[model samples]
Target chain A: MDRKMSPETRSALEKLADWFRARSIWMLHYCTGCGAVELPPSMTSRFDMERFGIGPMATPRQADVLLITGYLATKTLRRVIYTYEQMQTPKYVIGFGSCTINGGIYYDSYNVITRLDLYLPVDIYIAGCMPRPEAILTAFNKLREMIEKGEANGWKRYEENKEWYRANQLKALNGEVYVTR
Target chain B: MNLKELISELKNKYRVLDEKFNDPNHTFVSIVPDQLHAALGELKSYGWKHLSTISCVDWIDDNEFELVYHLWNWDSRSQISLKTRISRSNPHFPTIMHIFPTAKYYERDIHEFFGVEFDGNSEMEPLFLEFWDDIPPMRKDFDPLKYSREKFGERDYKVPFADFIVEEGDQK
Candidate 1:
């Protein structure tokens, strides 16, 4: 799965995949923090994320993107990993706030993980404490652009760097040492 | 009952150590640790039926943990905070589940956060902070920043922001 494809084959296949992925984005809304409140406005009448074909899915299996809406604690991050891995291939992760980027005000918090990317591959980051609904809409548009360009290969990055990502996950979650002991 | 009548009644029945009125509707009373159960029992018997919550404050400097049992009298429309100080080294307190059955959860929370053992509360398992392996997190000595640094890796900024600042017209 990690093998590199020739440029011609890669381009042809990715072009078709990207075209379909750009229009319809099924999101797994695993909201674990305060930023979840901002999503309602974005999905509702005023913003209408569905207008761009971005809609929430109940389970990760059906989703194309995983939307991590806020700060992830060590406990919740475990569940996030399970959800991320369950997502179908060519999946993307939209890290929702400064919390996902650098932990926001929870930077020194003992429970919250400082970065989202260390555990799962992130395709786009919406930068705010709790990003406004408009910012979320903009982020979704940017993600669509990335998808169309075939530049958002976070799922592939995860496939290639599984060992690195897993090691970081173990270190963050206290590793096999905690599991065994 | 009026606030003065209630205070005077409390004074007449038991030795009140210290009393402070924060407002017309709220009062705080501090008593010895030994008197906690009895005091709460007495208050519960006297129409102070509401157990708002049981909270603990770690007085690390004084080597004590102050347990505050907040009670409310719905009829009188007033609140009373009953306080008692227990030794920090051996922080154990009796369960007042008989007086307030809801105290079971409160005791569990106190046990989880402050490491205070509540005797008779057999279901003193963790209420929050599941699978926590370290010292009770709410203690004054538990440095959360140090814990966070040791656990969650902070991002290393390769280019410090100050170094990237551009002076006026320097871009040209």
Candidate 2:
């Protein structure tokens, strides 16, 4: 049952892909680390995120994507979660760097939360201590595909397993997720 | 070139920008928490471009966390760093989110990290650290090392297996 599309069919597919890729994404404009210091250069004339219709938004209510720059602290986690919750449905999260993914430079420190996924559902996880602006743009493109396919809602699991997440949230020093056998 | 001229110009035109200090990279102007809005408005008129990056530093021993608004302009390769020290006890300040779109994120981050209240921030919740106390770490006195050592044990690492051959120095 292997059926390959013809040239005209492929051309239409390409056009659909381009349309999805061009969707405008508004950033919540949150930056919580030294990594955030690098964002201005990318959002400005250098990277020109506006060229793709991606721009910074004033409110989470209007954002299509939440970009967590780096190093989540516990107290900050509450606010990040709150804001993420406020965003309308059909949203995506882009974990900007290693710190957002796994606390790259701050792993040894317990005060900072290592994984951002624990707070909000992330669509594309870009890895690097401080990824270049190009990496961010690449992640945005990857997100467009995910958005079209609708796979970024993996966080639904958190809603489904509320007690499990709470238990993990309130766990003791082992940093363990579940309570016991 | 010197700070005096800049201070004089600002003082003459605007009644804001209190407690000015000369830092290596740029000038540090301490605006009283109340005057931040006016000061920012005046700065914006000169093409500050609303590059607001608000962050907090813990100064717990002093019962304060310094909230900084680092604004920059691409038009001119210069920046005017505005700072305000607020009491950690109440930890509230007027939200600059209205003046600059970028402040939405920056203020939300400060609110979450330091438990500092930005009166009208679009997002008042946390940013990075989710499971944390009201204790603000960036304050000069939050002692991250102490927090880490207490929460997690001493650093754990496997021993290195490489054996080095020592060579004597050519005469002590």
Q: What's the TM-score of each model vs. the native?
A: 0.88, 0.46
Q: What's the residue-level lDDT of B164 in candidate 1?
A: 82
Question: Model 2: what is its DockQ?
Answer: 0.12
> Could you give candidate 1's per-residue lDDT for residues A1-181 as a string of tens digits?
3333333445777788888899999998888888889888888999899999999889889999999989998878888898888888989999998899888899988789988888898989999988999999888899998888767888888988989989988877766413322
DockQ of 1: 0.50
Task: Kindly list the per-residue Cα lDDT of model 2 for residues B43-160, writing each as its tens digit.
Answer: 7777676575776777767888788788776675567887778887888887776678778877777666566787876577657653455366555546776665455324344447
Fnat of every candidate, listed in order:
0.57, 0.24
Local error of candidate 2 at residue B22 (angstroms): 24
lDDT of 2 by residue, A25-123 (tens): 778856887678767887898888788778889898998788888877655565676777788755677888887766677865657666665545566
Best by lDDT: 1
Candidate that would win on DockQ: 1
Model 1: per-residue Cα lDDT over B1-172, one tens digit each: 7777878877777678888999999999888888778888888888899999999999999999999999999998999998889999998888999889999999999999999999999898877564687899999999988888777778876657887889989987
**Least accurate 10 contiguous residues by lDDT in model 1 chain A:** A1-10
- TM-score quality measure for candidate 2: 0.46
User: Which regions of candidate 1 fall more than 4 Å away from where they truly are?
Assistant: A1-11, A174-181, B158-172
Candidate 2: residue A16 lDDT (0-100)? 70
Every model: Cα RMSD to truth:
4.7, 14.0
